[model samples]
Target: MAEAEAGREGGESTLTVLVALGANAAIGVLKLIAGLLTGSAAMLAEAAHSAADTATEGLLLTALRRSSRAADRRHPFGYGKERFFWALIAAVSIFVSGAVFAIYEGIRTIVGEEAEQTAVLVAYVVLAISFVLEGISWTQAVRQLRREAAADELSPMEWLRRTDDPTVKTVFFEDSAALIGLLLAFAGVGLHQLTGSALYDGLASLLIGVLLTGVAYVLGRTNKGLLIGRQADPRLVRALRDDLGARPEVDAVVDLLTMMLGTDQVLLCARLDFDDALGAADLERTCVAIDADLRERFPDLAEIFLEPVPRSDPTMRERVLSRYGESTGLGRPTP
Candidate 1:
């Protein structure tokens, strides 16, 4: 059942990326034509934005495909982190292709001799059409996110912050920025029409650059954390610790560690103290049984390691203390 659900979500993510890619590809051409016709700095910046988004979608598609490969001898943990690496590249693309161009254009327009705007109506029409197309992509991203959040019993914002998958989040934020960029372009054109100065158009371009820069920073940071091996959700960690502590053979869960292996995948390591009365054979059997129980209960656990240790081992206690400080709750007496 868990595998089926994962496959379904993966399919949805791919569909989302495809939709965004189509929309951005079309939008980029339209924006570029409109920018050239109207000679509007803001419109040109938006064209660059769409181009970056199109590139990003392509990279995200690569991430999804490469990250889904099965484990191999070279990569025993699978290629899950491929998603993070490609997503990181996508973030850099946005900054380089979109943000930098926008900023440079804005500055050039502001300082250079003023150029008269032409075919203003063309810009407006293209912006409106682009808005509709972007809205479609944005709506799809929001729908997927909301459904996933609901399944986890979390608010949308909370889920976004904790989500392991970056593709949907990338689409959602990119479309959102696209929609806002359209509005900024619209306002720039309107202001230029109202007043003969090209200053407003240049300002709009600068704002778009700043916006894309912010989005790039956010996405880059998220992928960086994931690449660095962020832990599984706190709730999942606590639940697994409690379950292990309750086992009949486990005297105490001395230490528990968990890390995200990929989207919907986790790696767990636990140091446990078993009842002293258990024989060596019994200990082996208990470990096997515990591994099976955990795998059944938590389908996300892709790897599990169980270590037996005495609760009173000073070295082990110190190691736990160094890792978790005073909040190291494992092996403590019940209040």
Candidate 2:
């Protein structure tokens, strides 16, 4: 079941990335041609932005593939976090290729180093087409995001931050930035034509650069935090405790720890204090039953360890009792 879910998510990410890649690649080519023919600085900036987006999407696609590898002896936790590494690289590339270059071009045009286009029809046409294509890609990303968010019962912003899947998040932000960049390009070109000055065009380029820079920072930060060993969501933790505590043999839950191993996988370690009435043989059987039940409940839990400890130790028992309160729905005495 976990494998099926991962496959579905993989398919979704692949489709989203491919659509964005095709649109950006085509838009980049058109913008480059239009920029060259019309000598419009804003058009050139838009061309560079589209080219960078195409490259970033390719990088994200690679991340999705390489990170999906099954666990081996060398990587017991699997290659899930490789998605974060590649995403970080994409963010850095955007800053260098998209933000820095656009800003430079804007500054140069402002100083009259590049000629402004007096005939801007080609720029306008290219911008309009790019807007429509980018909008389509952005729409697809948002739809996928909304579906995932709904499943988790979270707002879009909350889901984006806590989601183990990084591909959709990256694409959503990139497409959003692309749309903004297109608008900036349009404004820059329009102002240059209206006021008979290239300064507005240059300023527009700077604004796009600022926008890309902000997007890159956010993407990088999100990936970095995930790569550094983020824990599984608290909701999952609470659910695990509630389900285990409901068992008649479970007296109390001592400690529970969980880590996200991959987009669709988690590792859980739990220390459980069973009722004192059970003998050694019954304890062993109970442990096995608990393990089976937990795995059944959470297919995404790739690994689980449940340690049965005697409740004779007062210090440890008291600590466990204090930690799990009534609010967790785990404090009720088992029937």
The C-alpha RMSD of each candidate to the native structure, in angstroms, is: 1.1, 3.1
How big is the positional error of residue 39 in model 2, measured in Å on the Cα after superposition?
2.9
User: Which sections of candidate 2 miss by over 4 Å?
Assistant: 112-114, 309-335
| Poorest lDDT segment (10 consecutive residues) of candidate 1 | 326-335
| lDDT string, candidate 1, 1-335, tens digits | 98898899999999999999999999999999999999999999999999999999999999999999999999999998999899999999999999999999899889999999999999999999999999999999999999999999999999999999999989988999999999998998899899988999999999999999999999999999999999999889989988888777888888888888889899999999888899999999999999999999999999999999887989888888888886758866323
Cα deviation at 75, candidate 1, in Å, is 0.3
Pick by TM-score: which candidate is best?
A: 1
Q: Which stretches of candidate 1 lie over 4 Å from their true place?
A: 333-335
Candidates in order, TM-scores: namely: 0.98, 0.89
